[model samples]
Target: MASGLFALLDDIAAIAKVAAASVDDIGTMAVSSLDDTAAAAAKAAGVLVDDAAVAPRYVVGFSADREIPIVAKIARGSLKNKLLFLLPGALTLSYLLPVVITPLLMAGGAFLCFEGAEKLWEKLTPQDESADEDAAMDPATRERTMVSGAIRTDMILSAEIMAIALGTVEQEPIAEQAGALLVVALGITALVYGAVALIVKADDFGVFLARKRNGAVAALGRGLVIGMPTFLILLGWVGLLAMLWVGGHIIIDGLAKFGIGLPSDLLHAATEGVAGAGSLVAWLVEAGSAGLFGIAVGGIIAAALHAIPRKGH
Candidate 1:
């Protein structure tokens, strides 16, 4: 009886030890996974910045009261796009049809370039008088239109973000890749929409503070109210540039994958050939080259569209 009891106690101890080790392993893996995801997400900073810069414009022209809710709606749509549609599709493609990834990425990148170029063209041209009339006519319709447009745009940007992330972690096990992508998707969506919420509301917050009795508070409020428009205009320009650069970068990278490596090689040699050039200079050169390439492609597409006679015209 004594021997049996001792044996039983030993078995329990071994089991506990095994459980502890298992727990430690799981904890270590979780930490490593998060770190990897963060690193991968960081690599896609250009797209992230463009995402942030483009989001606030959707809330423009809305009443102060509707800003936050509109942002929230867009945020929810963004989350759905990333998680529900893009995530599974990305994983499936990465696993099953890996060869197709590059072309698809280039396609999406071209769409982004086209969008950015169209916006630029609009900025250069005068707005139609009917645009003002439409804005004054139906608030609900305008809000829905803006929200739909934003979400559609978000889908393309989200696809790029996820594809870049997947490329970074392609060597990992599928499970780990899924976990990391989930973290990235949730994290980026929250960060982008949260920042946008704050941006759209800053003017209102400024007005509130401006109405306060404290001098400093009022001054700060006034500053925010005055600064936001200029800041937004600057942000718009940044967003446009980001779209061009990131889109061009994607296409250049994709071209290399498809046995056409000259562009990438030339870009590298041109940048690296600079004497005493550092990483920053190389990066800037690469980005500039990519942006120029994207602009050229986008310009051709835009001109083609312009050539096609519309129903009204």
Candidate 2:
């Protein structure tokens, strides 16, 4: 009996040792996955910034009290779009249709170019403002419609973000790809809406501080009040540039993969040399070249589409 009891204790000890090893293995995998997630998210930085920049426009006409609520609604919709809709589709493409991913990414890149160029086109050739459809609706109704519209718009951007993110991890195991995309979707959604919440409420916060506080605090409030509009305009310009550079790079790089290498050659040549700070210069030149390429491609696309005559107006 004594010998048997000792044998049972030995067995328990061995099991515990195996369990500890398994736990360590899992911990290592988790860390590696997180690193990949960060790198993948970085590749989509352009869309992420534009998402943040474009979100503010949705809240512009709402009452102060409604701003955060509207942002919250859009945030919820964006999450649903990423996690429920785009995530599975992205994973499916990576697993089953891996070959199509590059062409799809280029399509998205072209879209970004078109969007960026269209914005420039609008700026250069102003059209008479159409009356807003929501003008006749009650405030509550208008808010509902606006929230729905914003969500629809967010669906497009969220799809792009997910596609760009998944493209980065296409070679990883399916589980790892899922892990990276999950992190990106959750992280970016939080980042974008959190920033939007802060932006929409800055003026109110400033007003509160300006009225209810004094001295340095009050001066800070005044500064926020004065700075928010300028900050927003600057943000719009930044978003445009980001779209152009990122979109252009995607197009030229994709073309290189298909044996159309001239644009890619230009991109490479623009950044081919570097010594010390020249690396920084190389990065900028590469980005600038991509942006210019985007302008050319996007301008052609924009003009071609514009030439299509409008009907039934």
Candidate 3:
């Protein structure tokens, strides 16, 4: 009886040891998965930044008290689009038509470049402004319309972000790929909306501070009110550059994979020839070349599309 009791204790100890090892393995995998997801998501910065830049527009007409809540609602919608819709669709595409991922990604990249270039073109070209009569609208109706528009826009950008992320981890196991994309979807939505929340409320914060009697606080508040616009403009510029860079890189790399490597090879050689230039310079050179290529491609596509007449018209 004593020996049997001792044997049971030993078996229980062995089970505990096994359970501990399994837990450790799971923890390690979770860390590794998160790390991989972050790296892959970073590759999709173009869409991420565009999402961030565009989001503030949704809150423009809202009262200061309602800005954060509006952003939160949009964020929730964005999350739903990503997790419930985009994530599963992306995973299915990755699994079923693996061969199509690269070309699809390149297409998405081209679309991004086209969008960024279009924004630039619009900036350069003057528009004929006709004075249009305004219809009176209730505030609630306006807010609802704005939120709907923002969420609809987010759906497109989220799709691009998910596609880029999915392409980045196509080689991973399906489970890992799903996990990575889940992380990216939640993480990026939070990031973009969080930044938007801050942006829309910044002026209100500045106003509050400016009302303070303290001289230093007032100065700081004034600075914030002054600087927010400039900062937003800078962010837009950054987002445009990222779109060009990322789109260009995707096209160049996709072409290289299809045995048309001349452009990339030439760019690489030219960059490499720079004496004492490190990886950073090489990356910049590559990025610049890619941006130029993307812009050219995007411009041609945009022009061609513009030349076509609409069927309904």
Candidate 4:
């Protein structure tokens, strides 16, 4: 009896040890997975920034009560874009048409360049007719137009995000890749729209504060009301810059993969030249050079697009 009891205790101890080790293994895996996902998200910052920047325009004309709801709707569409559409499609592409990733990336990059250039062109050559048409539209029609435009833009930005995520998941197992992509999609959707919600409400917040009795509080509120519009305009410009920079980088990288190495070569040379300037300086120099290349490429594409003639109505 004594011998048997001692044997049972030993068996229990061994089982506990095994369970502990398994838990440790799982914890390690979770950490590693999260780290990898974060890195990939960082790599796709361009798309993320552009998405945030573009979403606010969708809610511009809506009543205060409707703005958040509209943003919510767009966010839902964005999720469907990634999880329902892009995720499975990306997996298929990875296994079946891996070679096409570079070309597809370049295509998306071209799209970003086109969009940025279009915005710039619109600003420089404002058309009174279009402005008049917009001003003439009823609230419902304007809202519809804005929602459709936002969804269409979301499709392109979502595609770019998925591609960047897919590229980063190359080494992971298929299941892990899918999980990571879903996480990234949901996370970014929440983040972008959440910020939009706050931005849209900021004016209301300012007005509420302005009604308060305290002079300092009213002054702060007035500042917010005055500053928000400028901030948004600046945000739009920044978004355009981000799109061009990111798009250019994607095209250049894609080109390098296909044996055209000029962009990477230039980046490397610049990095080396700035090596003695310290790590931060070197990194900035490399990024700045890449951005310049992106701007040049975007400009060329914009010029070509303009040069093409359109059909008469």
> Any idea what lDDT model 4 has?
0.72
Give the alpha carbon lDDT tens digit for every residue of 144-230 in model 4: 777778887888898987787677655555665566566667666776777778878889999999999999999889998999899
What is the Å distance of residue 120 in model 2 from its true position? 1.4
Q: Write the per-residue lDDT of candidate 1 for residues 1-313, one digit (tens) a residue.
A: 1122223323322232223234246555444455444433433555666777888888877888899889998999999998899989988987888778778878878877887788788888998766565466588988988899999989878888788767655655666557657766776787678778888888989999999999999999999999999888877777787778877777888889888999789877878786367877876787788888888878888899889999988
Model 1 ranges off by over 4 Å: 1-43, 275-277, 309-313
Q: lDDT scores for all predictions?
A: 0.74, 0.76, 0.73, 0.72
Relative to the unseen true structure, what is the C-alpha lDDT of residue 5 in candidate 1, on a scale of 0 to 100? 22
Best by TM-score: 2
Looking at model 3, which ten-residue stretch has the lowest summed lDDT? 1-10
**2 versus 3: better TM-score goes to:** 2
Alpha-carbon RMSD to native, per candidate: 12.3, 12.0, 11.8, 12.0
Instruction: Give residue 92's error in model 1 in angstroms.
Output: 1.6
Pairs that clash in candidate 2: none
Q: Where is model 2 poorest over a 10-residue stretch in terms of lDDT? A: 1-10
Better of 1 and 2 by TM-score: 2
For lDDT, the strongest prediction is 2
Candidate 1 local lDDT, residue 179: 67
Worst 10 residues of 1 by lDDT: 1-10
Stretches of candidate 2 off by over 4 Å are: 1-42, 273-277
